[model samples]
Target: MRFWLLCGAALAGTMVADTASADTLREALLQAYNVNPTLTGARARQRAIDEGVPIAKAEARPLVDSDVTFQQNYRGISPFQDNGRSISAGATASYPIYAGGRIKNSIRAADTRVSAGQADLLATEGAVFTETVAAYMDVIRDVSIVELNQNQVKVLETNLQASRDRFDVGDLTRTDVAQSEARLSDARSRLTVAESTLTTSRENYRRLVGLLPGMLEPPPPLPTLPQTPNEAVRIALDNNANLKASEENAKAAGYDVRTARASRLPSLSASTGVSYTDYLGTLDNVTGSAAGLNPKDAFTDSFFGLRARMPLYQGGGPAARIRQAQALQGQALEQVIEVERLVIADARSAFGRYMAALETIESSQQAVAANRLALEGTRAENSVGTRNVLDVLNAEQELLNSQVLLVTARREAYVAGFALLNAMGQAEMRDLGLDGGTLYDPIVNYKRVRNKAWDWSDDPAPTTQATRTATPEEDPRAQGPVTPPSN
Candidate 1:
């Protein structure tokens, strides 16, 4: 219909005007990667875990401490009868010569735990990016659907007007006019629903991307896909963060078992100390003896020795701990296997969905083409009196329905492709080519904190002054939202 043609042209013009300010999927994802609180928190948590390595290593290092003691003694029943003051200061150092490998195993366990934390951070990043991609695509898909519904409403309105004209001239019955009116009403209602869906989709986009969506450009194609489901599973097994984390945990648990067993073995250490004592006043009156009865007024004593300890008895606690650790290690190992199986299953399922979506897109395309031709033929036949207004309206409705399905199928295909990538642990900023900002590397923080002790200034300084405007190069999509054209 001419009305439909005009509507399409107007919509095209609106899109072109909005495209100047459009937000792209890549930009949205980049903003999310840079500002998402959950991902930042995960990085912080991993840094905290990295400190455990130094804490465990400290047990194998020398410990030095200083103590000062002061005391006043009063004799007899009166405060002034007899009084003496003594003060002593001492410094002691102890170094563990051997701990039956307990400290070594503990350090190993801590290292593995840090590795696991790093993997957990990677997993969190992937999840956040995956969610951002979906939110970005959802807004674009919903907006397109709304446009399609609006066009349908226009086409039905034109059909209803034509039906009314025909009925007034007795070419069509009143019942036929009513049918056209009822279909138009239905189309309007669907348009309202579609608009509501678009509003919801925009809200979701804002929640993930840290800004409300403007005119969204179409999404880009997904990254190169795996050749087969087996290939996808292979990729997932190799790159999946959850599986890596679980494997590291299992290693840590094995070290814990060793640590617990070592607790029951003998430990050897060496210690040395020097002490100085001073008497503030005579103590003869308090002791009822000579003025320097205790010893020299000022004296120093030095001593050094080796100490050995063996856990001879602890109510069977050490043995029980070893058993508990063994059980925990077994559990961790099983978890690793479980995670691998789940990852494989998820990867295969995602690939299947992606393939199905591609097929649906093809089917919907064919349907749209067929229905468009049918609508044109129905309109021509109606003009020649072979088909009526109802046939034209029905054909138009079929075409509209096919268009809706096509748009939805395309959206699904894109989302499913990303889903497959996510399952294979490849749905991240680097893989998506979303180089909009500085990429966060968890290793930078880990290396800074892993060997640090009693140091808070080791963290990297901010790159820029507290207040400054962003440079043009820093934000690639500063002009507006810009998504790639839909395939």
Candidate 2:
């Protein structure tokens, strides 16, 4: 007989009669990557941050504005009054020539923050992917547990019927029957709990993967693991997305300080514009036949000049801004060190847990083997009247316990391994080798909008990007595995 009952593939589809197809771990990760709401929102927020670069650059670009005005006056108050009707139109244009590095520094700060935002987006991806892995494995683990408990219930049922038969034949006592009945009842209760846990896990899977999971293939082995915990920590300090984001934030803050200081310096700009006004015969002083002026005659005004603004005093506002930026820059620098500490701690802890879980799995496998042998021996002795029914019953229970422990340990090992990878910054989409579609590149958006100048250009209206967990599979039991899954 097989050492343990293996979890089988689920039905091909949710429908009762559909062909069978199994869901792999890769598929779940891909689904979450494409449409998980949290990750999608992070990407959207990063895109918004990218716009800041262009917004900062715009401060130095030419600004053009135009205006038109129509007026009517009944009272003539000298040559300046246009009583009948008059229209005015004018346009103004200005370009910043210099700002003591304020514009340049501001753009640098925004671009650095964009880098920080991209790092934040990467962290979000890693976080969401980590959760998806946990959720996916949870369903698999719970399903295996439910199946094991179900098998236990069956075994107890067989024991109970045998106990009653033996008692009726005067070979076993009524206490033996009672004991079997009690154990069977307990196994059934445990089975209920296991199935309930399985249901909860399936709901979580649906939340992340956009549907209830079917049979899930075993996850592939983790790659590029560091040989030592110290190595893992070193890698994490260098590559952890959270830490990188903090460092980028610190760099951005430094740029902000420079930008603030530049504010106190004088700024120069060029201004050029044209203005026109039509009297429309309303200026009677200039529109009459005696005046020798045409009703259509208009005023044309043109000007070009350089503007220089030097701040002598501003109520200490610019100084305050500079000080505030300096303070924030220090805070950002401290945050980088703090994040580095956390990354180091996480890398070491995850590595320890993975190692411990692997050891547990090995030990539990041995226990399961020993217990199975013990139960077999106890049955043989009971058949020959050398051992009591209680002894056989105890052996069977021990084997079931060991089987459950082994399954749990296997689950723990896989999860811990994945967690270790995540802590070491090796679990994002690029490392996942997903062929589902093109990976999202934040640079695509940054490049698209960093120099955007069209005032009317805009993206399509935003819609709900994530799939709703509508009508999720209510009963996970119906999709129970039928054969062992391939890793």
Which candidate should be chosen as best, given TM-score against the real structure?
Answer: 2
- Model 1, runs deviating above 4 Å: 1-18, 76-82, 285-287, 292-295, 455-487
Model 1 clashing-pair count: 7
lDDT of 2 by residue, 1-487 (tens): 1101233333211111222466777778889998899988898899899999989998989999999998766545675544467789999999999998999999999999999999888888888888888887787678777877888888889888999998999999999899999889998999999999999999998888788888776666566467799999987877788998999999999999999988899999999999999877556543444554554567999999999999999999999999999999999999998999888888898888888887987888788889889999999999999999889888988987877777777677777777777777777887666777899999999999999987889899988788777543755544766677889
What would the TM-scores of all predictions be? 0.86, 0.88
| CA RMSD per model (angstroms) | 9.3, 8.6
lDDT of 2 at 473: 79
**Model 2: which ten-residue window has the lowest total lDDT?**
10-19
Clashing pairs in 2: 8-481, 8-482, 8-483, 9-483, 12-19, 12-20, 12-21
> lDDT (CA) for every model shown?
0.79, 0.82
* Residue 417 lDDT, candidate 1, scale 0-100: 83
